[model samples]
Target: MKIQEKDGTIVDVFAIYWLENETLFLGLPKNYGGLISYKEKNVHVIDSTLNGEFNYFSTHINGIYHWALIKEALLDDIIERDEVAYNRFVEILKAEGRIDPDFY
Candidate 1:
């Protein structure tokens, strides 16, 4: 998914770390390395969606953490776009058992 900055710059999202305690943490690439090299940099409440489809999220960028309401579709797209990463994350969740199998 692409996050647009106030100046119109777009940032591409890489992966999702997990959804914990009703919050979502997303992972983004940190260097020239691949997806495995990503690190968590953004967070938002899972149920913060408005109309059940939109919500604001926060991310730390350039020493500042900014918030913006983004389309939930974008988040779903990100997960769908990287099935391998998403599955790996789900496995981790299953191992931790933080969520019920039916929910994942």
Candidate 2:
């Protein structure tokens, strides 16, 4: 689904597997194809840190870590999670008041 951020930046959303113990979401948005540092930072690009990282994007929430945005490359991770239905992600967004119900 497409989510329009408060700043008018709408991006496609998908669900990916959660990385390790790090908190998720409400952080700066960054792009990465594989693992990278989970420490919070402000940057944009596909990170390639091998020791500790995973593909993730901030949920744009009001916290350091709370949510993440899924991308096309992480489809396998989403599927691997064995979600009951794809819309589960959408539901979570709606429940969290992140996206309007009609947006999806």
Candidate 3:
């Protein structure tokens, strides 16, 4: 799928919540990388840097994802295109019940 950015850019997406089953850190930088984005069914984008201690976090962290661990199954290359892969990934997560319904 393709997601559009506020600037009118498109992104790709998949049909899987990559790390929905992982335990989330309530309040700590080690695991609390900050919100990336939110999908459905409680799936979230925590951090996806793969460079910091919070590599487990998804890169999509937005107002949508808060502390939830659920996130989209983005291809390794799509991480940088937040609008394309990231948003679509979040939608898939939401449809699959990964993101919290109350988030939006």
lDDT of 2 by residue, 1-65 (tens): 23334555434333222445333222212222221222323222242222112344444322222
- What's the TM-score of each model vs. the native? 0.27, 0.28, 0.27
Candidate 2 regions with alpha-carbon error over 4 angstroms: 1-9, 12-85
* Candidate 3, position 10, lDDT: 31
The backbone clash count of each candidate, in order, is 0, 6, 31
Candidate order (TM-score): 2, 3, 1
The numbered model that scores best in lDDT is 2
Ranking by lDDT: 2, 3, 1
What overall lDDT, based on C-alpha atoms, would model 3 receive against the true structure? 0.33
Count of backbone collisions in candidate 2:
6
Q: How do the residues 1-104 of candidate 1 rate in per-residue lDDT, one tens digit apiece?
A: 43333444333333333334322334332221222312233322223212212234445421111111132223333334455544544444345553346433
Worst 10 residues of 2 by lDDT: 26-35
Name the regions of candidate 3 deviating beyond 4 angstroms: 1-73, 102-104
Please provide, for model 3 over 1-104, each residue's C-alpha lDDT reduced to its tens digit, 9 standing for 90 to 100. Answer: 22333444332222223344543222111122222222333333333322211223436531212222333345432334444554554455467664444423
